[model samples]
Target: MDNYLEDNMAKILLAGESWISTTTEFKGYDSFTSTKLEIGCTELLESLKKLGHLVTHIRAHDVPEDFPWSKEALDEYDVILLSDIGSNSFNLSNHVFSEGRPTTNRLELLKQWVLSGGSLMMAGGYLSFSGFEGKAHYSGTPIEDVLPVLIKPYDDRVEVPQGALPEIAVDSQITNGLGKFPEILGYQTVTPKKDAQILMTVDSSPLLVNRTVGKGRTIAYMTDIAPHWASQDFMAWENYGEFFSRCIKWLNKDLD
Candidate 1:
């Protein structure tokens, strides 16, 4: 176990990407309903795990209650990944919303954590980066203040059923050896923050943006790491895992 905690390994906290859904089905004059549980970041998680990074996944509903609210607790992770989760998860905790107790704001803690030398990454989804109908709602959160890109106030997802290929926008050591990527189905549209580096683009929108925040770093990938937006073809691409590994290394400043 000691070997697993080596300096080369990055500890990552991956929040969100898990959800529960209920569906109603009709057969002639009768109706039936079923509930299902799903996770969207399996591929991305597995990829990171395979690269020897330690990952702790906190589902969407579990975030408000489970996310660390203290800097001491937050120190356990070198990187925090907010994927497909909305702002409410950080703003409203069960202690405040259900138990009638005041609690520290997790989002504020996260912002401070990043500023004081922790890496942060936001991967896109329906509930990420000003998601569907603007329901993801991170525009006004403290998180938005540290992000490398500005989230549009309205719904930012651009559906591309026909697929859109990512174009390399900058030549940097972080993106070295990365070749042609597979076309993705869709992506969230975001403007790169001033002084932020636009690493990649899809159509006219920023696809991957990065910037340094104090001693730490922040990266925003404006597309899903899983399906619906990231197609099966994209996930199955030869460089899929390698690409993500590179991003993680870049965030940790381990890549040259």
Candidate 2:
């Protein structure tokens, strides 16, 4: 664990998505409070810091069309997280696809990074997985090649009013030792890939999944973090931090 952490420290990049032009748009309601320090990834960073990780945070705004898809940036982090951000962002104008041709394509770079063993995790939201009517369709990107779930031709999001109680995986490393955790508010229903291990399942679908992409591992949490969108349960739930932290640990355990 220590070797993985130390060796992978500089390789972890935490990319957050900010579509709202103003913080004023955010009203801490349901389970989110106006004063809560970490909504989205604000708290997630703190939690990662608590675990001794000094994360490099990049917002979707910071990336530009001419932005260099530097291998320095790619190799710097062991894991790159996409939370509610779309696939098109990385393919922005400045990025190069192959042979260093200038274009909006850092994905080929990201693909090489992962194939060479870099972890990636996607927490659910509008910019994730065929998000909101195929808005953030990750299916066509190199990311889709690594992700455990197949992106439906259209949106894969399912509205669950009654909510679902997923059956836990007995041998899940993520859920291991998490004794009696509070239930998640709700999960966005999705189809699972055969290559992926359905850690937790609902009905016949995969809710929590883990898969190995190249030499790196990827985990998918099909749920939201901010409340009212069914993430209220986890945010309000005491074990929210624990569960998320465990996920981070699994993704960047080598970074420690």
Candidate 3:
């Protein structure tokens, strides 16, 4: 591991990035259905783990129930990452949905936590930051206020099947030594906040952005860490692990 990363080990809580799919097959007059579970951040997880960072992943289905609802619970980790997940998971808990009881507003708690010195990051995907059909729906939410970018109203995704290469919009420690970025298939369209720094861009839009919130900081990486958006070239890049490890160090305030 690079000395830069070896000294900045952090406890990271990764939420979302997993999904269940159901498919039905038809043969003549008969039909069969099967369900499969998939996780999208295997490469990212492995990279972080290799750097000696402790990562806890909460799958999409388990987010509503398992996500921390209190500041102390949240403070256990140095950073929290929301990936391919919507606000609904944090909004609608089992108590509210099933028992018709009120629960702690996790989103609001997250906002306060960040302001009080917690680090946060949101990665892009189908269910992330005003995602497909606006289903990810982080727009106008408390989380949106803390993020480095403004989430657009509906369907913020910009699908570029031809591949959109990301460029360093500004020089920063997070991007310093990293060479040219490989092309990404797609990314969300977001506007950088007035005080935020646009570290990376794709198609002239913000791809990686960062800002300080009170005593803490937040990052918005508006592209998937996995395939379909993160191209094979991007994933297979020699500096893939180094790049993300640097991001973690930056988020944890280990990088000056």
Task: Please give the CA lDDT of all the candidate structures.
Answer: 0.86, 0.64, 0.90
lDDT (Cα, tens digit) per residue for candidate 3, span 1-256: 0111333488889999988999999999999999999988889988887877888888889999999979999998899999998999999988999999988999999999999999999999999999999999899999998999999889998999999889999889988878899999999999888999999888888889999989999999999999989999999998888888788889999885
| Clashes per candidate, residues 3 or more apart or on different chains | 0, 17, 0
User: Which regions of candidate 3 fall more than 4 Å away from where they truly are?
Assistant: 1-8
Locate the minimum summed-lDDT window of 10 residues in model 3: 1-10
Poorest 10 consecutive residues by lDDT, candidate 2: 1-10
Candidate 3 whole-model C-alpha lDDT, 0 to 1: 0.90
Instruction: Give lDDT tens digits, candidate 2, residues 175-239.
Output: 77666544444455566678888777655567678787788778787766554444455555665
lDDT of 1 by residue, 127-216 (tens): 998999999998878898889988888999899999999989988666667788889999998888897999899997899999998888
TM-score of each: 0.94, 0.77, 0.95
Better of 1 and 2 by lDDT: 1
Off by over 4 Å in 1: 1-7
Candidate 1 weakest lDDT stretch, 10 residues? 1-10
TM-score of 1: 0.94
